[model samples]
Target: MSNIIKTIDVTDSLENLKDVCDIENGRIAGKIFYDQAIYEQELEKIFARCWLFVAHESQIPNTGDYVTTTMGEDEVIVIRQKDGGIKVFLNACPHRGNKVCFAESGTTRGFICNYHGWSFNVQGNLVGQHESGIYEASDFDKAKWGLKEVAQVDSWKGLVFATFDPQAPTLQEYLGPMTWYLDALFDNQEGGTEFVGGCIRSTYDCNWKIAAENFVGDILHAGWTHDSAARAMLGGSVAKVSDFEESYSVNWNGHGYEFALDTVGNVAVLGESALNKYLHTIKPSVAERLGEFRSNMIGAVSSCTIFPNFSFLAGQNTVRVWQPRGPNKIELFTWVVVNKSAPQEIKEKWRKGAMMTFSPTGVFEMDDGENWEYCTKTAKGRVTAAQDLYIGLGMNSRASDTSLPGNVFKGQLNEANARAYYQQWFDHLNAKSWKELPNRNFGKQEAE
Candidate 1:
């Protein structure tokens, strides 16, 4: 926590925002899915304060390379500077607030805004203007008219992140124990991971949290929601996720995942024999590099969500940032991840495998968006939004092993992660500052 008071000023009270989630009693209010005021509060408290994924280091390896993304509704440009450092800037030009960069990603020497011909270099410095003589004698200061920069920018194993709040914790401190689990996906090999190609973007008519929470720990839905996808890909075999032994949902801070140590079970679901074999062949190497405990997660049945709306499939290797378009909609950006050291063929297989299973039109991905959309659409009803949704499954259950790094619960069907996530959500919304936020998720003590 910072010594400075980093607080969100959502002064107006919302009638439906109160008691949206009661972690103590395992009650989840449907209004969390779609409430205008709650959504605005989230933008102020969560997105503006927390570290959000912006772009991968692999995406922009050279100077002047850039990518455009969003922090809540504020569009930002992530560019590689001439000094080899990365910088994130608000995409709007200071001249008239028009977007300086229109392309999602490409190499650029500088941003020349068509609105006023205001030119900014890759370092986010205003270097030129349409006419130099007109403003020469005026009181205009070119130095103060550069693009607005984000407060912090950093990366963990090639995954770049940025935050808007200057008083927020550093990227490493924010990640905490979540990095321990993330190693399986990011640092499984010596070279670490990189995005395979450009991302696949799609629009979803759903609250971002609905899709995020699904990946966080809702493994129970895999059997029913994606049954057709399983039948289509796995030759009519569905991996039983309900009571799987050696599987757990680990919650740390607001990040969480549900996983089964059934090695290659997820890879097999890709319906690709080559990819399955490749993952199987690398098990010993991964185990030696990481550990037997962590390596077992490779090609396993798992899904994870990092705090607010960043999600990915572990074995499937598709990363997603569920960008909030509004309370009732999201713009999902999808990318495939592969170990940088892997062979070209292996990397290609991983890319295709992820696309086959988790891309926008992929079987599993197709099954999820509609359900989330309907769940969000239903919350618009006055009676429906007021009612509490049941999240009492595995209620009062404690992890048999408190030695785990986080709040780990045995079984994939538990809603413990969902409860913990909402706890964090409410904590962010209710706290006066980041210093006041409670952090009891990671500890030796069992979660009550």
Candidate 2:
């Protein structure tokens, strides 16, 4: 254990506003960039307690269809039962703790443990126990031994999520004001957005937060970090002060905001002419159906991090599951969320757009990889790792908004959303349950 980690005062290291807030500062203080100890606590406090995305409803549409993955460190299998409801359970066997299902994902009428032949149905009910003669009914309570269920499982739009903490709030309550914005993106559509296909899986050598933060708040990197790639794709140089508009929003359970430039507008300026022509041709049709804003974003970049770990980038049309492998490593599950009923041609277009923007070989993805690597490298240094990180962007810019809850700023690029995320993160780290959060702010904002 001694060789396993180093500890830093997160509270103290998080104090210095200027240095912490400056992107340049984050570039400098490298310790927190990738620390194992910080990652461990994140699993217990953040991933375990918060609502981590599991799979989209589209992934498991029919009864008994399932997908296996991890929520924090606990392996989980989410299945669509016969009744059309969703259930999430530990993918472990009740008998000997062996993994019950080894396949990554598939439809299953039920599962039987390979080690002991203990069988369980999709509902997680233990149907049979091997060697039943020796052990009486009293030996194992089938009722008590049903595969351990996740504490809470819920869906927002078509996205499914699970929590390990029994006291965690329902998905809607936890999303807070962000729900309104999410609805605009996901629900306002014809049938809500469904995932395009199976996820795009990859791994990163940096802290999970690096990916999360970059997805949600780091819109400043596109033009430069991706400069060469952008030029190659567009056949021209990226504009120095690219007119990309950015914004941020915050929710109670650390949910964060992102506002991005319109896809057609930005892509036309920075992408190939052929791609731009295709986008322009399809623009009118999409705008006619989904309306101008969303249709305009058919390939535009929009994104948000719903606290803890679920992040989606709209411009890229990629929904990401940042599963913490540890403090310094994370497994990325990237899925393209689209309307299940979209025209086959449109779906194909969306797929192509996703491939060009966020796929493993995408230019944007390559740019991010470079930065994520550098961010993680800093933590290996002894002298630089001790400095505090910052979130003080547009500190004075925060103002209460009647249009939106929490706090809102006129322009989107401010760090108020990031600060709000940390505030909620601190709350979760300290509180044992959701019951504590309301008392802390139960009616303070409403009372005011």
Candidate 3:
């Protein structure tokens, strides 16, 4: 409790912005979605400083395989090395800041700048400049002119993440207890997971946090927002409006997941029978490896967000990164992840299932985008921006001691995870350094 108090200051506006979220009271200021200053601050304090998902190892398996992505606002290249290590570098050329990698993804021995013919190797070392010895007299060195590299890059279960802050904790340490839940999906099978379907991208006229928070623990909206999609696809067997047995898990660094225990097979709207059969086939192995709790999550429809802006749906097998474009806009990149060792039939089914449910034109995806767009649009109004949004559901409920991780709330219909998320966001925005950040536990008494 003392640690929590030290991190928050509701009355302070030292940086020309009010405390947009009050985690202790479960109130979020609407202006957070529409304010430019807050958005810029988030880009600096959250996106630049925190670990962000770049690409999965499966996406770039071979040497020289690469993917272009954004780490905060800077474009970067995530490339594989000959030594079996991963490296990330600024996509811009050192000479004139022109982008060197133009393709979205492909295997190439090296990248050449189209603007001036400057070239860099797979390791990001400048190999060929347009003119050799042009600046030799000026102490120009190709060794010091390679593409700028990210301070840190690491992978966890094939998921690649990069950070600009060298002082930031390792990926595993930053992920903390969230890894327990992630492994349940990523490492459930013997061969682990791989990104299968080609990426689906779309833009939303809403703040990126809106989408991230929704995936984090907003099951409250599924019953209404996605009701039609569920009914149209599953004939009313999925996303029911009735109460269901569910649980919520939150981690120290703001990562969270919400899952329903009873709606396992019913959640996979595409080829439910086939998917269910497959789950049963793999259940024994998964249970033996990850224990009963995770094995039981095989077919359960669950949504999770990895802190800042990476999110995914477990049952649908869709993973996404919400790339922030501005205070009220985002370009969403999505992919379907599947068990690497799954039968071709199972992988195809999961791929098609993700396309049907969570793709850009997906029934559920469109509905969610509409809601978030309007939510952001409304917040632009002066009256709407000043109102406090209530997120107090299950705030006062007792924390359940569980073998899972973080603060485990007993039911899924709780805002406990969202509250913890905003608390972490607030703490990040206020902290001057990583060492100054507080160890926030949201008042949970038990320790893992």
Candidate 4:
């Protein structure tokens, strides 16, 4: 309910975050993209509280399998236990606060701290150290010195997520209505999906919000920014930027998807003819499982973001996590996804195809880094950072239909989703807890 920005005090800045985006009117303050206090609040309120992607279940199918990842900026080790359950532990050693495991991923019986040899098992219990009897009489209970564990770890389909806040909602509830669209990416095959091979990590000199918001509704940029990549791919490796009349932007809570509902347009551009053919064979099945609307989404020309920082290109076969580094920087982790039951050759094609377009050095990926970086860099200008950006393009473009899920907008070019996303960003920073966030049953709503 507050709207003013006059101080750098943490409390004042957080209070003013509500002023950063005016969803009702379609306007946003530029500083929300690079403000330090805002970023600090996000690390605590949003990243720590919301469910965040860690690793795919495929990455750790057996006991002791593990992957090192970050929830917000806090490094964590997400590992499978002997019971075939996953647990996420803070990677910092309790002994001296040094990193326990440095490897990005691997299978192991336990983790040994490199600094002091303080070791912990997959369950995060402190097992031993260099000397066994050194602290026995010193009131040091080894049982109390285990690595900090996340309060929650869960998965939907094959994607794993974790959260540090004990009061955070279940991952299923956090995902909210986004599940309808997620099924298109995840539930396409009988065996579900898994990430193919290793992920690609790269950094962008931009705020995490800037990159996340881009995927929320910036498909309009497709026609202009990525045209060259589309041309260079010889038109077959990327879908044509479609006319506004054929596309849609839909959001639920803060999660959003923008797509041209041309079913095979997404995979067709991967430059894998057989992959396209394969998807065609299953299109009927997808339609039957999810109905005609989401069936068209299985391989459509689309980009989506699940609130906070996780995003993926529906047709491009790339999944991304925009990890925040600081107010002015973000680390991007990219992965190619394929059906768990897919043919090995088809999975390989997805891997290579995703690499060709979204890897660190891929054609489409190269075109976006600088643009995002510059957006963050330029916002440093004192005057520029204070201005309000006009996001009113689709202020009245709402689509009222009970058939489609989420807050649907009529066109992909609209800024409705971006506005909704920023509003959620504001709400998270301003709320006392997750319980204070908005909750409205969305049905028969319009996008305008």
Best by the lDDT measure: 1
The 0-to-1 C-alpha lDDT of every candidate, in the order given, reads 0.83, 0.66, 0.80, 0.81
Which residue runs of candidate 4 sit more than 4 Å off their true CA positions? Answer: 1-15, 236-246, 439-448
| Candidate 3: segments with Cα more than 4 A from true spot | 1-18, 237-242, 263-267, 440-448
Per-residue lDDT of model 2, residues 1-448, tens digit only: 1111111222322234233234322222455456565555566667777778898888899999999999887898999999999998888886678999988889998999999888888888878877876557556566666687877789888889888776666676666656655654475456778777677888877777677776555556765677777777667655443355543344344566555436443444334455456556756766666566545555454457888778876534568878878767778888876655556666666667677777788777877876787778776777667666655666666555554555555445555656555555555555445655533433223212
User: Per-residue alpha-carbon lDDT of model 3 for 1-448, expressed as tens digits?
Assistant: 1101012122322263335687777799889999888887788788878899999999999999999999767799999999999999888887788998888999999999998888988988878866667767677777877777887889999999998877778787788777778887899988789988778888999999899999888888987887777777876655452366555545466888877654354345664567777877888898899988788776676689999999988767788999999989999999988898988988888888877788878888899999999999999999899889998988667465556566677677777778878878888888765776787443343333
Question: Please, what's the RMSD in Å of model 3?
Answer: 5.2
Per-residue error for 322 in candidate 1, Å, reads 0.4
lDDT of 1 by residue, 152-193 (tens): 889999999998888778788777677888888898888888
- In model 4, residue pairs whose N, Cα or C atoms come closer than 3 Å (at least 3 residues apart or on different chains), thus clashing, are 237-269, 395-448, 396-448, 397-448, 398-446, 398-447, 398-448, 399-446, 399-447
TM-score of 2: 0.83
Candidate 2 weakest ten by summed lDDT? 1-10
Residue 36, model 2: lDDT of: 64
Reference-based TM-score, model 4? 0.93
TM-score of 1: 0.95
Per-model tally of clashing residue pairs:
0, 13, 0, 9
TM-scores for every candidate against the unseen true structure: 0.95, 0.83, 0.93, 0.93
lDDT of 3 at 77: 91
